[model samples]
Target: MKIEILGTGCAKCKKTKEAIEKVLKQTGVEAEVIKVEDIEKIMSYGVMITPAVVIDGDVKLAGKVPDEKDIRKWIAK
Candidate 1:
């Protein structure tokens, strides 16, 4: 699975990345995690908000930081 975190490197973005990382570590899910910081690249995903989470090229969460439990559920899918 591929997980991409889209943001402009703000506090919320960082938090989202950290939360995803924590969940991946705790769950031992082997997936590629990427941080997309470029505005053009992020917009290509049709995400107007920072701190978006994309799982396997699909937008799963957007505009906010998701908790570990939620992240785990997404990853499991």
Candidate 2:
């Protein structure tokens, strides 16, 4: 599974990335996690908000940080 966190390196963005990393570590899930900081790249995903989470090329969460449970559920899918 591929997980991408899109943001401009803000606090929320960093938090979002950390959340995913925490979940991955706790669950021992092997997935590629990427941080998308480029404006053009983030916009290409049609996400106008920072701190977005994309899983396997699909936008799962946007504009806010998600809880670990929610992230685990998405990662499990």
Candidate 3:
């Protein structure tokens, strides 16, 4: 599974990426985690907010950080 964390390197975006990584490590899930910082690339995803989470090319969470439960559920897919 491919996970994309979209942000411009802000604190919340960093937190979001860390949270997802923590969950992945705890669950032993092997997936690619990418940090998208390019404005054009991010806007192409139709996300106007930072700290968005995209799983397998689909937008899952946006405008905020996701909890552990949310990360687990997303990785399950």
lDDT (10s digit) by residue, model 2, range 2-77: 9999999999999999999999999999999999999999999999888999999999989999899999899885
Q: Counting only residues 3 or more apart in sequence or on different chains, how many pairs clash (N, Cα, C under 3 Å) in candidate 1? A: 0
Compared with the true structure, all predictions reach lDDT values of: 0.92, 0.94, 0.95
Candidate with the greatest TM-score versus the true structure: 3
| Pairs clashing within candidate 1 | none
Model 3 spans > 4 angstroms off = none
**C-alpha root-mean-square deviation, candidate 2:** 0.7
Encode model 3's per-residue lDDT on 1-77: one tens digit a residue.
Answer: 99999999999999999999999999999999999999999999999998999999999989999989989998985
- Tens-digit lDDT track of model 1 for 1-77: 99999999999999998999888899899989999999999999999888999999999989999988889889885
